[model samples]
Every structure is written in C-alpha cells, then in structure tokens.
Target: MRQLSELDASFLYLESANAPMHIGSIYLFDASERETPLAFSTFVSYLRSRLHVVPVFRQRLKEIPLRMGHPYWIDDPDFSIERHLAYVSLGENSREASLMTLASKILEEPLKRDRPLWHITFVDGFQLGGDKEGNPGFALIVKLHHAAIDAFSGAEIMGKLLEYTPKPQPISAPRPWQPRPKPSEERVMLQAGANILRTPWRVTSIAAGAVEATARGLIQKQLRRIPLSFPLFTAPHSPFNRQITANRQIVSAKLDLSRLKAIKATLGDVTLNDVVLGLCAETLRRYLGDQNASNDESLVAMTPLSVRSSTLNRTTGNQMSAMLLDLATNEQNPAKRIRRIHWNAVASEPYREAIAADRLTELLPSAMLALSARLYSELQIAQRYQPVFNLPITNIPGPQVPLYLQGARLVQQYNAAPLFDSMGLVIVAVSYQGSLTLNFTMCPDVVAKGNSLRNHAYASLDAIEQAASMLDPEDMHTPLEETRSQSMADSAMNLLEGSLKKLTSRLRR
Candidate 1:
C-alpha cells in the first residue's frame, strides 16, 4: 500500500455535507455516424477493458487506526467495475438544462469511501436541438476524487481511455491480482510515530527553503520594477464570498480557440491564458453592473499551477502549486485589464507553494493536518476571514484533434473544479479539439442568474476579441521585466568593456 500525499489527503479532510471535493468533467460524444450505436453495456465493456491501463480504478482507500495519519491506497480484492458505473437515460426532448439538472443531482451525493473514489454515469438519448434536428448523442459524467488526479493527470487518463480511430484496439492481458493483508494497528502506529519523528527536521528545512525563495522572489521583483497586486484577503466583500449550500448550478459555453489565438496575436505578447482571465473579469464586471453593485474592487483568482514534469514519477496524486492572479476587474478597458493580468502572471512565480507541496508529505503530521482542515471547514473559518481570493480559475489545455470512444466522436468537453465552504463560484476552462469550453460551478442560491451570466461570459469573449482587433500594433509595449532584462544586459556589456580596458592599461605599464 502507498500513502496518500498531504495534498491528496487534504481533499478528504475538506469534504463536508455542503462541499464535495471531487473534480469532474462532462464529455459529449456524437454517435450518429456509427454503424451500430453504443449502449451502456458497450461503454462498460470498453471501460473494463481499459481498467488495466489505469490501476487507480481498482484501488480503495484504507485509513489508519484512529486517524493517526493520511490514508493508503490498496488493491480491493472485491473490485467490480459494475459498482462504479451507472446508466441514466433522458427523455428524447431533453435539452442542455435537463442534463445540467441531472448532473447537479448526481454531484450532490458524495462518493462512497468503501469503494474506489470514482464513478461514471453514462447518459443517453440526448439530441442536439439545433440544425441537426434528430441526431442523437450521449454524455458521460465522469466523477473522480481530487486525490486520484489533478487537471494534468485527468487529461492523460482521458487519452488512455479514448482512441483516435474507431477500430477497437487489442486489449492487453490483465495481470493476475492478489490482495495483500491489511496492516496491523501496531504497524500503522509505528509508521505514524516514525513520521512524527522525522517531521520537525523536514519542516525546518522546508521553512528555510521557503524563506530563501520568498526573499529571492522579492529581490527579483524589485529588480524588474514589477508592482505586485493586493495581497490575500484584499478582495472586497461580495455575495459570492459567503457560505453556500450543497446544491450546485452548472453552466457551460464554447468559444473558438482559433479566434482566441488570433486575438492573442493581435494583442501583442499576451498569452491565451491572459485573454481567459480578461474574459472572466469582463463577465464579473457586467454581472456586478447588472446587479447595481460596486464594480470598483479588483478581483483576485486562485489558479492551480501544475508542478509535475516528465522527470517526476507518474503517481496518482495532486502535483500542483497555487497562483493568485489579479483579475483587475476594476479596470474598464479590456486591453489594459488584460495587460495588468499579463504583467502579474509574468512577475508571479509558484516558488513557496511548489516547495511546500514537494515536501508536504514529509513536513506535516497527517493527523494534525487533517484535524486542522476538518476544523476549518466544520467551524466555517473560511466565512469568518476575508476571502483569500475572489474565486478559482483553472484552465487546462486538451488535445487538439478529435478523440473517439468506440467510434463515437467527442464533440465537446466541460470540466468542473471543487468549491470550498465560502467560495461560492469556480470557473474551469478546458480546450478540446478546436474549441475552448468554460465550465462554471456555483451555489445556485448565490448566483441565481445562471443563464444570463453564461450569455455575458460569451459576450465578454467577443468584447475581448474586438478590443484586440482595435489595438494599435506599434503602441503596444513589452512587459517591464523584459525591458529591465535588456537594460541589465547592456549595462553588463559596458562594465565588461571598462574592465578589459583597465586590464590592458595595467599590462602595458
């Protein structure tokens, strides 16, 4: 059995009746072109064939005695794919709204811990009501515990489950499975004690590294003349920052990635991510404006920055750092707002969080860590403090080419990130094939304007594209950090020349 990382275990602690800490995606597939359409049984068979590819599906969590520490993942001897897979059939006239309602209901119930912390609900009888009048399709609502996979690994798992061609791929032979005996209570206690013994030194070293990284970051920021935005808890009080119920509202929209790229090119050096932040800013700006609320407060976003690389071990756990980006919602001009966001993105580095996450399992005692997290949620400490950030925005890049599941082409995909107690709303952006999909998950009571908000989000993207087109190419300036780097290079060259001349004079004398 392998121990769960602190980052992964925290999800378990943070979960509550009101807040379910699982991240999921809604996958839409068009099956009209297939000679024989797929059914629930077919989907289950395909998934079962691919189970060997992803071992996490067959693993279950085993908590230590008396909650001494984090949980461990062990192979379940009684693992059954049927237990994790369910089927849901909608009416022929079901629309997007109907599907969303079903999704919300499914998400309200937490995943059972006795089994693997994942489930997939296959939805059939969905018909695209637009120009393609009667073309039928299917939707797959995939629910996986955050402990199992983050955004990067989630996409990787999707690739493993899907294929580029309709032809069935030969399934590899499954290894004969054997379950190991559960660890004794004494063994668990001994391991927890060992971890306790090592934590102090580990934490001390990590603290020192974090301090050094922070100091270096501050110096670098000063050298570059970069102005940092407001600190955490600086976000103004808003309705979205209050406690929320368990009921969730889901909304989604698709935008053209080509258009986003064209807009990015027109906007000079700003990235596609900056454009996404700008779109969120405009969406909130308009949302507040419509409510007659104050829109002068600058909003901050808590974006997850993945730290995993090819060199790291491919484990089933969270490998990410935290980035707090300034959305600059107070800025009226979309161009300037995006520029500020770009500058912040350039100046910010995921130094401390990355270091902490790398050593989290070693530094923190799991029992105390879990206890603190549980207390934080149970007591609603999040509501007491000013919000650290206004909301979370995670944008994950997806495959550029279409993916197929048993010959059914995947048309669009939307992903939803978990929300905490106080933070009522979170935005997850994912790009698939040629389209970028925005998925918004929030407390329905807090954000009752779901439909209108989605429309505003769409319009905001258009506005950003328009603003990009109107930008004067010559007027755009490079970021201050880049300019400072160039200046420092020129100064170094001059200093080198002066030193060379001095040396030559000394030699001649």
Candidate 2:
C-alpha cells in the first residue's frame, strides 16, 4: 500500500469543525432524455466496474493495522446512493438563496471516514424562472476530501466519469471481488524492523537538511519576515477570524471569460488570473470604503501554488506552497493595479528551497518524518514568521468542453475551498467551458453584507474593461463615448456660468 503524501496528511490534520477541508464543485445541468430502467442499471454497473479498476474509489482508511494505505474497496460494504444524493425544493425563493442554504448544509459537518473518501449530492427538481428558450436544470454537488485529489487530477477524474457522446453502449460483466490478505503480525514486525534499521542514516540526513534550512532562513530573513509586518486593511478583529461555528456561507458569480479575454488582449498578454485578482482587490477596496473602514495599507492575498510535476498529475494530496501578494488597492486606477499584479506575480520566486528541504525530510525514516512534520505544524513557523495575508485565492481549471452527468448537460460550475482561522475570506475561481465562475466563502461576521462583494466584483471588472479599452492614445483623449457625453454636459454648464457672470457685470455697469 502506498503511504499518504505529506500534502494529503497536512489537509487531514488541518481539518476542524469550522473548516472541513474538502473541495467541492456545483454543476448545473440542463434537462436531458430520461434513462430507461436497463440504462440506469447499466450506468450503476459501469460505476461499479470503474471502482474495481481504481483502487482509490473503494478504499477507506486502515488506521489501526496500517497507518494509511492505498484505498481498497470495502467488501460487502454498506453503500447507499440515496443517502449521498439529495433532492430539495425551495418555496418561492431565488436560486441564489437556495444554493446558499444548500452550501451551508453541506458544510455543517465534516464527512465520516468510515465510508468512501467522497460523496455526491445530485439536486433535482429546481424551479428557476427563465425565458422559454432556457431549459430547466438540476445541480450536482461533488464533495471529496482534499487528500483524495488535487484540483487538476480531480478535473481529470470528473472527465473520466462523464461521457462525450449522447448515448453509449453499456459495458458487460462486473469483476469478481477478491480481497487481498491483510499483513500478518510477523509482517508488521518485519516492517518495523526495517524502519529501525534505517533510523540512524535517516536521522543524520535530516539533521544535515535542518542545518541547511536554518542557514537559508537566516540569509533570507528580511524577505521572509516582511509578510508579518504587512498591515491588513481589514484588520478589524471579528468572530469570523476567531473560533468559527460549524456553519459556512457560499456565494458565486458567473463571469464571461470572453470579456476578460477581450480586456487581456487590449492590455497585452495579461493573464486571466491577474484580471480575477484585480477584480477581487477592487471589490475589497469598495466594500471597505462603503463601511468607512478603508485603510491605505495594501491588501495581501495568499495564493496557493501547485508544486507537482506533470508525471504526478494523478497523485492525490496537496502539493502546494503559498505566495503572498500585495493587492495594491491603494491605487485608484484599475489598469495600473492589473499591471502591478501581473508584474508582482511574474517577479515572485517559488519556494524551491523549502520544497527541497521537505523532499529531503521525506527520505528519512517514517517515524522521524512524522515527528518533524508534527513539530513544524505545531510551531506554525510559516504562518507566524511570514506575513499574514488577508485572504486565500484558488484557481482551479476545468474541462474546456461541456460535460454531461447522468444524461444532463453540465452548465455552470462553482468551487468551495477552506477558509483558515486567520484568513477569513477564501475566493475560488473555476473555469468551466468558456466562463470563469468565482465563488466566495467567508466569515459572515467579518464580512458584513457578503452579497455586496458580488456587486463590487462586477464594478471592478467594468473599471478594468474601461481601462483596457483606453489603451489607444486616441481612445484615452476621447474619454469613451459612455463618459464623453456626461463630461460634455458638465463642461457646457461651466461655460454657461462664466457667460452669466460677464452679463451680470455689464448690467451692473
């Protein structure tokens, strides 16, 4: 059995009642042709067949005999698809409110580890008002432990589960279940003996690595320590950042990627990610300004960076480091902020040294590695010594083409990420098809009027779009047709006032 990766273990350990530490997606599907009884059985049978091939699908933790091993399907296990999937009907309410309520329910408690590593809730019977052309749709919420898959691999797994064609022939035959023999007491003792044999060399290597890390930390103390002193604009202590209850609120916005792409084209090679961050920064700025709690200090965001190689794409667990970015909200111009963000991201360096140190520790004996990890986590050297960012931003890329689930055409998608105690706000962006849907999950107490954040986000995008359009020197002088008319009206009033003053002077003479 393969051991749990360090990234996966970290997620498992960091989980608490307030934060479940699971990544989930909400997919809206247009109504499709109904499946026959035989077809439905075929679908379930296909899933069962797939599960046999994928070891992770059926595996539950074997914590007692073995600490953690590759998941093996539980034989004759209790499997209830109905319990995992739920159907709800809202009474005379907006879809957004219904979705928010559903999100709150999902985050109410962490998943039980006695069963599978993941669960899905297929929500049908949604009654959203729309034009005749718009068809009725249902939502599928898929929640999986972070240890089970990274964002990229998760998308791949989703692709595998869906079909490209409208209707396909069903596969025949379920594989016979054959449980592998559990390791005996003697085998366990033999494993322990092997670990003991390697302990000395492992200790020596770890000690040397620690020395090197210490030296590097000393040399780069200034850069590493800056995050600590960086003042947070919304540093107002709120219940959100304090100990949290087992409740969560999720809000999402479907943004047009084509608009973002248009802006990027005008701005010259700026990434869609930069545009997203810029919008978030502007939104925060406006929200704080509205509350009269605006600060001149730059807002910082913690962006997770994936460290996995192409070869490790299917590997589960978190292989992530963070980069603290200055949102530059103090700047009034949106274009300047976008440019600054792009440059800052480009200039930032990856934590290669720290990753190397982590890799070195992995080479040590299991016991020693576990001990070192525990010490590091308990100390929280990264959080304490490093500057505390205001929020966490995650970007998960999804399938470019339309995806279908159970014959329904998948439309919109939203991602829900965890919010740490210190970082009250977590912004997640998932690109599905041609749209970049942004989801914000935050502490309600800290961010009062969370819905307003969506409005500000739209305004920020508008500002950026306007700025990008003004890239042409001629366009800049013309003041844009939308603004030009307003400016002319104001100028005309000023000219009339000057003429009136002269006429009054002549009359007085």
Candidate 3:
C-alpha cells in the first residue's frame, strides 16, 4: 500500500461539503475527419487499456484505524471503470457557454472517497465553437482530487494518456490484470508507527532548515533591498476576498498564443507570464471600475509555482510553492503595468526558496495543518486579517504540439481550480496547440458580478496588445513614482483604509 504524504493527506482533511478540493479540465475534441463517430464502447475500451499507466485510477483511499496515520492508497478489489465514467448529452444546445454551465454544476459537488479520486465525463452534442457551428465534436471533463495531483502533475499524466502523433498504431487488448493483496492490519500499524516515531525529529530538522533558509532569504532581500511584498502585511481585501459558497460560475476566452509571445518579444525583458498578468490586471481594473469599486492599490495574486526537479520521475501530489505577486491594476498605462509586473516577478525569484511548499508543509503535522485550515474557515478568520494575497492566479503550461485520444484531435482545453473560504476567484490559464485559454473560476456568492470578468478579458487583451504595439521598450516604465515598497505602499495605504471602511460599514449594519 502506498500511503499519502502529509501534504496530500491534508487535502483530504481540509475538504468540506461545500468546499471540495478538486481540480478539473475540459478537453474539447474535433473528430470531424473520422469516417465513423467515436463510440462510447470504443472509448471505454481505450481507457481500460490505459489504466495501468496511472496506477492511482485502480486504487482507493484506505483510512488508518482511528485516524492514527494518513490514508493509504490500496487497490480496490471491486474497482470498475464504469464507476468513474459518465456520459452527458448536451443535446442541440452545444454552445461553449452551455458546456461551461454544465461543468460548473458538475464541479459544485465533491468526489466520492469510496472510489479513486477522479472522474471522467464524456460530453456529447458539442458544436465546433467560433463560426464552425454545424461541425459536431465531443468533449471530456476530467476531475481529479488535489490530493492525487497538482496542475503540473496533471499535465504530465495528460501527456501520458493521450497520443503525440495523429496516426499512432491502435492499442490492443491486454491480458487479465491482478491487484496486489491488501496489506495485513499489523503491517499497516507498523508503517504508521514508523511515521509517528520519525515525526518529532523530522519536524525539528524541518524547523531548523526553514529558519536557516528564511534567514538567508531575508539577508539577501536586505542586501539587495528588493521591495517585494510578503503575504499578510501587504495584500488588500477585494470584493472577492469574502467567504465563498459552492455556487460557482466559470467563463473562458481563447487567445492566440503567438500574440502573447510577440508581446513578450516586443517588450524585450518581459515574459509571456508577465503579459498574461497584465491582461488579468486590466480585466480586474475594468470590472471593478464598472462596479465603482476600483482600488488605488494594486491587487495581489498568490501565484503557485511548481518546484518539481527534472530528476524526479514521480508526477503526482503537490510539489509546488507560491509567491504573492502584484497585479499592478492601479497602473493605468498598459505598457507600464506589464513592465512593473515583469520587474516585480524578476525581483522576487530569490524568495521562492524560503517559502517552498515542501518546507512549509513540514512545519505542521498533517492533522494539525488540517485542523488549522478548518478553524480558519469556521471562525471567519479571513474577515479579521488582511486578505492573504487576494486570490489564486495559476498558469498551467501545456503541450505546444497537438494531442489525440482515440483518434479525436484535442482542440481547446480549459481548466478550473478548487475554491475555498476568502478565495472566491481562481484564474486558471492553460495553453494547448498554439492557443491559450483563460478561464475564470468564481463563486457567485462572493463575486456576484463573476460573468462580467470574462467579457472584459477581451477588452483587456486588446488594450495591452495595442499598447505593446505602439510603445517602445524604453518607454514602457514611465512611472510617476520610481520605487514601490514592493509596489504595495506607494498607493496600497489606500487599500488598508478601504478595508477598514468596509469593515465599519459591516459593523453599522
């Protein structure tokens, strides 16, 4: 039995009825070239053949006796592919909007723990979106628990499941498979006992390492004077920073990846990620301005960074860290906004080592970590503290080459990350086959105007594109004030004041 790590197990403990911890992707495939339609039986057969590739599919969580240790992943003797697969018919209304709505509804519920922490829904009646109306296509919605894999790991698994070439040879049926016998209870106790005994020394060692790394990081920061914004002290509370509900709405817009790359090239020192941030910043600026809730301080985004080493062969669980990034929404000039984002990201690279997820997860026991998270939600702690880096902004890199499953060419792919208390919005942008699709995953309870965000993304991209086209690289950083206290204090005092005012208004009511 393969036991879950402390980090992976926390995802299980942290899960609530409303706040489900799962990540999902929608893969729309174009099978118009096929002589015959892809049959459900054929697809299921193909999936069954590939089950051995991702071993987690045949395993389910086996809890320790009386929660003495993290859950163990054991082969489910009765595991059936049918339990994890479903087919949904979209009927005549196969527009992109309808697909997104259906996805939102499906994602609103948590996955059953009795089975493997993943589900694949086959969606029929999908029209080829964007002017190609009558051309029929099908889609697959895959949901995997965050405990099973993070975004990077998910991408790796996706690559393994699909084919690289369009004309690959067909996969033949395999011989009957056998699962390893369930481990004896005595062995389970022994494994858990080993982990328990190691926890004290391991935790001490982890603490010492964290302190040393933090000291080194602070010294580097002081010597260079990188005015980078840290978490609690700087992030401002936005409208979306309140508690969220299970009611979710997702919106997506596809963009030409080449245009973003060209912008990155034109901007010289800027990266494609910087360009993406600029577009998101402008999107928020427009949405907030329309709602008459614009902030003088720029919003901060907690950006997740994958920390996987090339030598490591495993592509599962959460091997990631995060940095709090300034979106620079307060900057009106599109060129200046992007450049600031680039500079800030470049400046903050050194600090990544201090806050790596591996180090942070070791600071607390798995059970304690889970309990703390639950208390933070139940006690409404977010309302009292400065919002911890507004919301999550994750960028998942995808294969530039085309991918195929069962001879159907994958066209557009969109993804959504799970939401939690005080984090209503999660911006998940993924790229596939020369196109980048930006998806907004929002809880309608906290962000009432969630739909408006995507519509504004187009305008946001246009504005940034125009600015990059017209301006020279040297002219991008024409800032009124040169320095930012990591760009937080220059105008961020306004946010602290704004948060106070909001709090006061709430008290009055």
What tens digits encode model 3's per-residue C-alpha lDDT throughout 1-509?
A: 87787778778877888789999888888888677777777888888888878888888988775455678899888888999999988875567778888888988889999988999998887677667565678888899999989988998998898887766448778547798888888898788678767643323323333454454455545634544343445577688888878888888888888988988887887788888888888888898888788579889887788888999877877888766677788889786788888777766542333245544344454444555566667645565566667878888888898998777789888898998888888999898878888899889888877778878988888888888888865586554343242444323434444654564354334
When 2 and 3 are scored with TM-score, the better candidate is: 3
Which residue runs does candidate 2 get wrong by more than 4 Å?
A: 32-46, 52-54, 64-96, 128-134, 168-177, 184-193, 196-242, 312-315, 351-387, 471-509
- Clashing residue pairs in candidate 1 (N, C-alpha, C atoms within 3 angstroms): none
Give the candidate number with the greatest TM-score.
3
Q: Write the per-residue lDDT of candidate 2 for residues 186-278, one digit (tens) a residue.
A: 765555446436443433334434464564455357544565342222223322234344557777777888888887767664687888888
Q: Pick the candidate with the highest lDDT.
A: 3
Q: Candidates 1 and 3: which is better by TM-score?
A: 3
> Relative to the unseen true structure, what is the C-alpha lDDT of residue 449 in candidate 3, on a scale of 0 to 100?
74
Ranking by lDDT: 3, 1, 2
TM-score of every prediction relative to native: 0.84, 0.73, 0.85
Q: List the residue pairs that clash in candidate 2.
A: 59-71, 59-72, 227-387, 228-387
The positional error of residue 236 in candidate 1, measured at the CA in angstroms, is: 1.9
